[model samples]
Every structure is written in structure tokens, then in C-alpha cells.
Target: MTSAAPTPHTLLTPGPTPIHPRAVQALTRDMLGHMDPVVFALNRDIQQGLRDMYGAAPDTFTALLAGTGSLGMEAGFANLVESGDEVIVCANGSFGHRMAEMAARYGARVRLVTAPLGEAIRPEDVAAQLDDHVRMVAVVHGETSTGVLNPVPEIAELLRGRDTLLTVDAVTTAGMEPFHMQAWGVDYAYTGAQKCLSAPPGLAPIAVSDRAFARFHARRSPTPLWYADLDGLRDYWVHQSYHHTVPVNLHYALHAALSAALEEGLEVRQARAAHIGQAVYHTLEPLGFRHYVQDPAQRLPTVLALRLPDGLNDAAVRAELRQREISVTGGLGATAGLIWRLGLMGESARPAPYRTLMLALEDILGVPGLAGRFTETLTEIEDAVPA
Candidate 1:
């Protein structure tokens, strides 16, 4: 009998990035009852770790839901946005558009402020969209589509002193960048375990400020989604009230992932991400390439959006890279076919793989002089990777 071919797995995508071996082992740990004291202790530790990761206060209503980043987004909208309530959504990429869609599903009157793909939304533009009727202002901290980092701090400053709640999607920015929930005045924020956290996808790490919790308390109508209801989920996660079955092993993995982040230190992790991102840009820039987002300061460190070479097939190049055991991603939504989304996130966000990708691309594209430059870039990057 012929043996089945070995399965291959290479995740260089923006999300669901490569998981650490230790975290994967944590997932195989023995399971416990969700309400067990041991489980509760694990839960508490994870919540505190999340707060530390986000630079949030201890009293913040932070919880982990058993789902991807989208589940957290739904939870935020379902709990905070009531039917017919007006919300201002800033859309520059696919995830921003997704936030608006989720709000609209919750019966929110979504007033969208859009910027072109690969562009950042100016705070002035957001202020122009604000009205007395708007209850919440939603924005994506790091748009994975075009690798543009929106000006959350500026937008938050603009919304200060106003009754409007500020919600942010930090899915790609959470562990990879510097995000301070309390300092930034973000009322609610959500991220996934897969991206910068370097864990398997499933658990959504969510944080809500005291003011956002008060809004939840004052809600007159029921949340549209049952599983994503913050009130109910909070009861189970924080208050220890049984609502549904919690994934015990997944929680183990989450706790381990957070522990890894704490060990690495948030500042160090952020710097590492930034360093790798800059290395990638510097390596590509001299090869007649341009970034999708012009401003380097406003780009996401975890995801890089590069313009495809003239006359080169973007999809074909991605496929070629895959054959070499690398898996970069394509653009999302409106950016499809226009850019390549290279993720330098988590475990895979290192020099070796990135250098390998560059060399492989050079070999395939027959780009003269790339090999030598790639070698020099690799040496520089290797020296820069954290000890």
C-alpha cells in the first residue's frame, strides 16, 4: 500500500500566524471543568495578563471569548449598540468595512467615513462625520488589508469629553504594537490570539473600560446575539455564572500565549515587530518596489502591503512562493490583485523566513542584484533579532 503524502502547513498570513511549540503543547494539557477553582485561577491570570498586555487598568472588564477576532467584534457591537442607535464607522480597508457591517446587523444606523484603500483616515475627517446623534465611533487600529495604521490616538482625542463611546479593533496590532487602552481612552477593544499573540486562532481577547461597562448596564434592549452577549459572557467569564461550555484546553493555550508575551515584554515585542517590518521594507524598497501605504510611520508593523511589480502576476508569484514553503497573502476586498500582504507576525516575524522569502522571489523573478543585497540584508536583520 502507498503511504499518504505528508501534509504541509505554512502560515505566513496576517492572521492565524505560526504558533509557538510551547503554546501548541499547552493546548494538549489536561482539561478541567470550567467552574473548577483551578480553571478560575487560570481565567483570572489570563485576564490580568491581557490587561497588562493592553496597558489597561486592573478594574477593566476584560474577558476571553471562545472564537476568532470577529466574535469579539460582534460581542462589542451586540452589547454596546442598540437597535436604531447611530454609530460613526471609519472605513479604510476590509476590516473597517466589516465593523460597519456588524454594527448594521445590530440595527445600528452606521454613518460611514471612508478613505481610499492604502490610505489612513485623517482625524479631521472623522470629526466632520460626528454628530449629536452618533453614540459610538468605531475604527480599526491596524487595518490588515492595506497595512495602514489608523490614528486611533488622534481620533480618541477628538472624541474626548463627548458622550460617544470609542471602540477599536486591534486584531493585528494587539501584541505586535504599542496599544494602551486606558491611556488612549479606548472604551472597548478586541483582538485575537492568532496574530501577534502567536497562539492558535479561537479565543478573542476583549477589554471594556468602566464607561463602556456602564453603557452595557444601561442598555434597555437585549443583545442581538446570544453567544456574543457581553452581559451573559461576562457573567460566565468574570462572575462565574454558567452560561455555556467553555473550551478548557483553549484557555490553557491562551494563558500560555499571554505568559510568553509577558516573558518577552510588550515593549520588546513591539520593537521586534517594528524592526522586522523596517528590515522587510528596506530590503524591498531598493528593488524597484513601492509600498501600498506611502507613509512608513502610519503602516502596521505586523502586516506589510507591497505593490506588485509591473507585468508580474501577483497570484502566480504567491503560488511560486508557496512551492518554496513560504506562504505570503494577497490583498483583501478592494485591494485584491493590487498588492501583496506580507505578514511579519508572531513566531514567523523573524529574519530567516523573511530573508528566505526575498531570496526565493529574486530567484523566481530573475531580479538582478537582489541575491547580493538580500544576503547583506539578512546579515543586518540577523544582528537585529532579539536575543
Candidate 2:
């Protein structure tokens, strides 16, 4: 007997989040010439929206690339760090390690300040790594691998009054978390449209401070990567200089997504994320599960990392959940078999899906006491739901 394919459902992963209906419509709208006035207007609106979302200074230059979050990571490093420069890369998770790799690819001498997965980097440790030769200090604002939220504000304060420029990977925290680029003293920052922005995967929204741009201008050798070179891409995005053909439909979708974010208000969006995260913590703690990150303050509201039960097969548990038409991710890199990372991001960062997930998981794990607790929790959740 043939079983039908699992029913399609919403994305509960950290990135490529659930898209708004309006944004989906924008993607289906008639495509226009890349150089058309209408397309250019859409690009302008996206840039402005990005600037507002980042809380960038008025003079900061913002651009969008036809790539994912990794492209933005490469762009920021390729444009800023030249050969023989020293850079400090914070490595608390997979994404932070990627930054170090990109810097090394560009010929920079990369020094790593690493912590165990699920642990935040101490600002003093970052400061200790800084030296006269260090040109940049790069950190990830939200490490999706372990659900650890790095203290970017504290790290920024440590770099204050220093010659080293600060760069942040806010791919998972951009719209959902509080990221004030100018106020946080981040000279360069990059994020993906798919994550907190709740847009489809494609465009990377990036912002650069005046100081970071000056460094780019001062590079003795041209940045090697053409597709990501800020000096050239900035002209195309801001001046309409036409470096390459733009993605018209994606830009329209991004514009609509940004508009929705603004209408929801950043504060409200952040509060929603926090509320869902708290509920998840409360719901999961009594199920014989424990968080990977011991400190609540270091955990991100969008992603939660749980240590699997002793003797339980992580992959099999994930497969069982998949059978029930629910999906959650495992940890990355060294923590893969040891942890399960559940993302409560954007539209999926709500109570209903989480409650459903808890019920499904309780049935799968089938621990002695978890089923009863899960039943009680589901009843409480149902009672809380509006009529």
C-alpha cells in the first residue's frame, strides 16, 4: 500500500521563514526590466527599509545583493579586510567559524576567540585578542547552531575608542531582535531576507558605516570577489550604475516584507518572539529535557537548543517527528548528535505550532511521565486560545 506524501506545512526553521501573503503576491507580480523606473523605485524602497531596520545612521550606505546570508558575510569581509591585515573572528558556533574562513580566504591573518558551543563570548576575551595589527573584530549576533545570542552590544563597547572596526552577522536577529547598528557601534553588518524578515531566500540586506566604507576605499589592491565587491555594488544599488542585472521580483517581495515588518512595529515583533520563546522554555523544561545553553540571557529568542535524552537517538527522534508532519533541526558541527535546535522564528515563532510540536514529541519520545505532562500542557494551551 502506498502512503501519500506528508502534508505540506509551514516552515519552523530559523531561516527562509514563513512569508507573508502580500510578499508571496509580490513574487508573482509581473516581472519588469531590471533597469525600468518601476524596478528602481522598488529597489530604493528596499534600501530605505533595510536602513530603518538596522537603525543605521543617515549617512550609512545600504545595499541588497542577489544572494543569501553567506554572500553578505563574504561581501563584508572581502571589502574590508585586505591581504596581511589582522582580524579577530569570534567562533562560538558554525556561522562564526564561517566568518573566520572567509577572512582567511581573503588573505587576512585570522585569530579566533572560540568558546564551547552554547556559550557566549566574553567581551574581555575579545578585547584581549585585539592588537595594533587587528583591523576588524567580527562576531555573530545570533548563533543559530546552538541558539546562543552573542552580546554584540557588550562587544561593541569593548571596541569603542579603538582602531579596530566592528562587524556583526545579524542574519538570525536582524528584524526579530533589537539590532541598532549605529547605537551598537557596528561598522558593518549583514543579514538575510529569509530569517527574521520573513521573506523568501535570495536577497541579503547589508549596511556599512562611514568608517568601514573609508577602509574599503583605502584598500591598496582591488577586492578579489567581483560579485560581492561593495565599492562596485554600492554604485549599482544607490546610484543605479548597473553592475549586473537585478532580481526584480525578489526586490518586490522584499519591499512588501519590509513594509509588513514596519506595520507590525519592531518592538511588537520582538515582544512576540520573546513571548513565544518563554512559553517554549516553560513547556519543555518538565519533559525530562534540558537546554544546551545554561544561561537564559545568552539564548536567542528565535532558536532554542535542547539536549537530547540519554540513550535516545537524535536522528530517529527527528524522523519520528517528521512522520507526524512536523519538522525541527538538529545542531550543527560538533554538537549535531548531542542537541536539537528548535526555531521559533518569525510567523512560526508562535504558541500554536510549539504546542503541536510538544504533543508530537511527547508521543514519539514516550518517556514514562512526559505524556501526561504533555497532555496537561496541551489542555492549558487550548484553554488559552481565543474562542
Candidate 3:
């Protein structure tokens, strides 16, 4: 007899996470005028929620761009870096390299401080690249490619009292973890709604400190890009001066997502992510799976990468999971086929998806006895999950 098929696929992939019900309902709302009072209220709440989630100071200028996470990266680089400016990019994974590329696009002289995959870049290594000429220091808070969570707080600390501005791609970390950008003195940080906020892709929420705004306004070059220009975005988001037609409908979904997150509270959301992460590590370690990331503490709770077990086919195992109606992804760049990335993000971080994943892994890894063990291991995780 065939095993029971796990129908109605559960999404367990990082980014573009399973959309929350509130977000889905949010999309069904009638569209409003961009300058409408209701929209302005939504814009205020979204911007405020972004500030609170990011740990931004009250004076920090925050806005949402109608694009994916990559566009936020471009806006951050373009607004700050100009011709002949020097920027330091901490490269530990694919996103870090993307930051360097973005800086180069703006004609900044980019210096890269890189580390091995699965290893977080050292603060000292980042400090080594610092000089008076370096105008900005960019790092990925959660390097999803390898599931390595960089030391953003320490890196932010290193830039303290220095002239170099700090920018972070918190695409995979922001709503799921404590970003601490204001406390860390980060000048600029950006996150997408898709990853941790449980929203569909499109809106990128960003926070920029007063100092960063000062630098942006002081730029020698006139803002070259119209759509993504921070100055125009600020005018629209802050003063309600029309920039372009603001995304009215996407705002509905994104606002509901952020509202759900705020309702859940950051501390609780973080704990939920941690609860799921512990269960994953607990199941994998005994099954003899090796972590791609060296330090467990440096691992991202939202995104986890593990080496594929010996004798297991990459496509076959993934296909098996797919047949079970579970959606997980593989590695990218140099780590492809060597590791698989499982996302425990937002609504996907809940126990049900993970229970299926664990069972699937047990079957795929040929551990028949793990069925009993999995049940025992998840009791603690189950207790913490909200009804």
C-alpha cells in the first residue's frame, strides 16, 4: 500500500512565505485613493510599525517602496553612494555580494570583507576595512544563502562614532528577530514584507536615520532615479505630497500583515521562530545531519540550511517532499546541491508545517524509529505555540 499523500502543499521555503489569512482578507478590500484619509492612516501605521519593528528612533524617516527586497537594496545604495564614494561591503553570502554590486552601480569604490560560507564575518575583519574614506558599511543581517546570521549588532557597534554610515539588508531577519537598528546606531536598514511579516511580496519597508537623511540631502548629484528617490518618497510619505501613484491595493495587504505582526507582538513572534528552530535542530542533529553554518548562535531562526545527507539525491529528496505537498528550496551559488534551505518564517513557522517536515525527513533519511522520537521532541514547542 502507498503511504498517505501529504496533499494541499505547505510552504516551508524562505521568502515569499505563506501569506497570513489577514493578509489574504486584506487584499479583498476595495481600493482607496492614495491621498485618501484612510490610506494616509494606513501609511502612517505601516511606517510606524516599520519603525517599531526596526527599533528606529522617532525622528527616523521610514517608507514603503512598491518592490521586492532587491529594489530596497538599490534604493539604499543609490540614495547614499555617489561618484567616487567609498563603501565597505561585508560579504559572507549571496546578498552581501549583491550589496557590493549595488554600490558599484552607484559609482562607489567598493571594498569587500568576505568569509567562508556558513561562517559569520568577524567584527574585527569588518573594522579592518574601515578608513576615513569609507562612506558606508553594508551588511546582510541574515544571509539566507547559507542561513548565517551576521553579527549586525557588533558590526553596528564598530561603526559607532565613525563617519561611515551603516546599512543592513534585514530581508530575512527583520520582523522575525530583534533588528535593533536604532540601538545599534544603524543609519539605514531595509526589509521586505514577504519574509518575516507573512505578507506577499511587493512592499519593501525601510528605515533611515536622521544622519543618513542628512548625507542623502547633501549629495553632490541630483537624485538620478525618480521612482526610488528618497527625497520624493519622503515628500509623499511624510508630507502627503504626491510622488507617483502610490500602491493603494498592495498597501491593504501589507498593512494587514504588519498589523498582525504588531498584534502578535515582536517578542512573541521571535519566540515562536525560536521554538520552531530548536525543534528543527533537535531533530536533525541526532539524525546525523550537519549544519552548513558553523556556529548555531549565528544561525537564522527564519531560514535554516543543512547539508544533504550522504547517499541521498538532492532532486529526488526535494521531489519526494513535493509529492508529499511540502515546498522547500535548495541552496544557491557555490553551495547548490550541498545544502537545502528550509524556511520557518511567519505563519510557516507554526508547528503543523514543521511536524510534516520532520516526518518527511525521517522517511527520507531512512530513520523509521524517528516517528516516535519526533513526537516527544515537539512537546515543548507545542506548548509555546499560540492557539
Error of 3 at 348 (Å): 1.1
Task: Show model 3 residue runs off by greater than 4 Å.
Answer: 1-7, 361-366, 369-372, 381-387
Please identify which of the two predictions, 1 or 2, would achieve the higher lDDT against the true structure. 1
lDDT per residue, candidate 2, 123-196, as tens digits?
Answer: 88988888777899999999988999999999899877888899999988887756799998999999998888
Clashing pairs in 3: none
Candidate scoring better on lDDT of 2 and 3: 3
In order of TM-score, best first, we have 3, 1, 2
- lDDT string for model 3 (1-387, tens) is 899864667899987899999989999899889989989988998888888889889878898998999989999888888989989999998999999988998899999999998999899998898888899999998998999989988888887788889999989888876778778899989988899998989888999988898999899988667788988999999999988887787899888888888788888888878777777777777756678887888888788788877866888888989888888899998988888888877898887887778778777867775545555677766776677
Please tell me which predicted candidate would have the highest TM-score against the true structure.
3
lDDT of 3 at 202: 88
Identify the leading candidate in terms of lDDT: 3
User: What overall lDDT, based on C-alpha atoms, would model 2 receive against the true structure?
Assistant: 0.83
Candidate 1 Cα deviation (angstroms), residue 154:
0.4
Candidate 2, residue 142: Cα displacement in angstroms equals 0.8
lDDT of 1 at 384: 71
TM-score, candidate 2, is 0.92
**Residue 108, model 3: Cα distance from true site in angstroms:** 0.7
Better of 1 and 3 by TM-score: 3
lDDT of 1 by residue, 171-236 (tens): 988877678999989999999989888888889999999999889889998766888787787898
- Candidate 2: which stretches are off by over 4 Å? 1-6, 366-387
